[model samples]
Target: MPTFTSNTAQINFQTFGDQSNPAIIFSNSLGTNYSMWQPQIEFFKSNYFIICYDTRGHGKSTAPQGPYNLELLGEDVINLLNHLEISKAIFCGISMGGITGQWLAQHYPDRFNYVIVCNTAAKIGSENTWLDRANLVREQGLLPIASTAAGRWFTDPFIQSNPTIVAKLSNDLGAGSPEGYASCCEALAKADVREDLSKIRIPVLIIAGQQDPVTTVEDGLYMQHNIPGSQLFEINASHISNLEKADDFNRAIQKFIV
Candidate 1:
């Protein structure tokens, strides 16, 4: 396991295939970690250098106290790349990670070759909604809504076939640090990248899960409309569509990047 420490946080990361190959950095959804990309890693490792890391306060990473925003989160990625001496790479992100990808493309265009945003949006939700959810989580841990969230995240068939994955996701969400999670809630609440879309000049691929309630196909459409010449692909899955439809997701990514 490779690791990088900076700015009072430690990010645990894994590298697949070879360093000499072009790097494809992956960022996972909120409450999940690099392990969320497990399905795609093996498939891409032979052709591309893969980098997956636990975002701050997720997975093996330490939970640092933060009122985290997109800029800070984006900086974390930049710092990791700097530490690795990586000049540029492709960015692949899901959900919250997708939001981060948009931010990176907007604020740090020189550092990325392409960005793949899956199941995310320019603005996550209203500030009040996130604040309310954070307060609710603070008052009553995430355990209560774990099943509900999971239900919305995956299709019924996926849940039926992958009970263990569902359980792990529930555990991850339920076990998240309240402070960290709350901070991210604030991040999501305040995030809006529509105006920044024009700043990104790199090729972009927007993949949306058609059934995602949190960030629907409309969200991907909005991104496609906003970013110049951006591409969109919709799959018949829920929020964590990459897991439910990994083959399609992987194929789309391979085609887009090439």
Candidate 2:
């Protein structure tokens, strides 16, 4: 694992495949780490230089104090690119990471050839909902949230069939840094990019889980309608579509990037 010191946080990341190949960076969701992208890594490693990193405050990354914002989150990726000396690469992210992708595309259009945002929304939940979650996590810890995460993350059929994967992710969420998770909740609280979506000139692909309850297909449709020339792909899964429908997810990415 390699670490990059970006501003106030030390970002933990791993890279694989040939350096000469086209680069593609994967950002994790809110609770999970870069390892969540294992399926994507294995699928694309041969043809692409894959980059996966834990967002600040998740996985091995450092968690600084107080609430964070989208600007800080977006800047972390830019800083990581500069550190790797990568002028540009393909960006793919899910949930929280997906929102970060929007910010990156809006602010640093020159640093990416294509952007794929999955299972996310321009504004996400209302500020009150996110703030309440942050407060609850800070007060009671991640247990309550982690215990019910599977319900929100996957469809009932997927949960019943893929218990191991679900358990691993839920367990990881349970053991994550409370302060870090809370800080990100605060970031989501203020992250609203609806007004800025039309300004994004980069090529974009939006992947929405047809069964996702958290960020619904409506949310994905909103993004697709607003982002100029963006395409939308729907998968038959829930929030964590990449894990529940790995083949479909990979195929969508392959079709969009090429």
Candidate 3:
């Protein structure tokens, strides 16, 4: 694991597999950190160079002031790639991480070969809702929302059967600095990339969860419709489909990347 300073933030990240392999970057959902992509890391590491990082405010990465924006998050990844001397990569992300993938695809098209966006929308929730969450998390920490977020993340059956997995994810999520989480809340609040999706000319794969309350299947459809050559697939899970249906999730994208 290494830390890359991107502007004001020191991004914490881990790389897996051989450096000679083609690079592929994975971004986590808002609450969790790079460790969330462990399953993907283990699966893809042998064939593709895997780079996973903790977004600002989560994990061991630096969380700056509140009210963050998508540009900064996108730049953080770009800077990290620059630090490693990687010209471009394949990017995949879930939830808020998907939002970051969207930003990079549109604004820095030269930096990626393709993007896989999972369980995310061009514009997530309302600004007011994000503002409220930011205020609450800042005052009371991530514990309060962590419980509710768990429900959105895992289906009931998975939660009951995989208690240990649920508990560890919840811990990694709630462990982040409140200020960092709140700042990301602000970023989500202001992030509305619906109109600019036309700018993303690269190939795209949008993954959706049938039971995802956070971002519905329609959200994935919207992205698919907007991105010219984009494709869409759905799984029977919640927001964190990658975790609940790891094999299917990994299999769906293998065709495209391989």
Prediction RMSDs, each to the true structure = 1.2, 0.7, 0.9
Q: How many pairs in model 2 have backbone atoms within 3 A of each other, for residues 3 or more apart or on separate chains, i.e. clashes?
A: 0
lDDT of each: 0.87, 0.95, 0.90
TM-score of each: 0.96, 0.99, 0.98
- Give candidate 1's total backbone clashes: 0
TM-score attained by model 3: 0.98
- Per residue, candidate 1 scores C-alpha lDDT tens digits across 84-194 of 889999999998899999999988889999999999999887899988977887788777767577887898888899999888888888877666677778788888888
* Candidate with maximal TM-score: 2
- What pairs collide in candidate 1? none
Q: Is candidate 1 or candidate 2 better by TM-score?
A: 2
- Candidate 1: list runs displaced more than 4 Å: none
Q: How would you encode candidate 3's per-residue C-alpha lDDT over 44-149 as one tens digit per residue? A: 9999999999998789998876578999888888998898899989999999999889988899899899899999999999999999999999899998888777
Q: Which has the greatest lDDT?
A: 2
- Candidate with better lDDT, 2 vs 3: 2
* Model 3 clash tally, residue pairs: 0
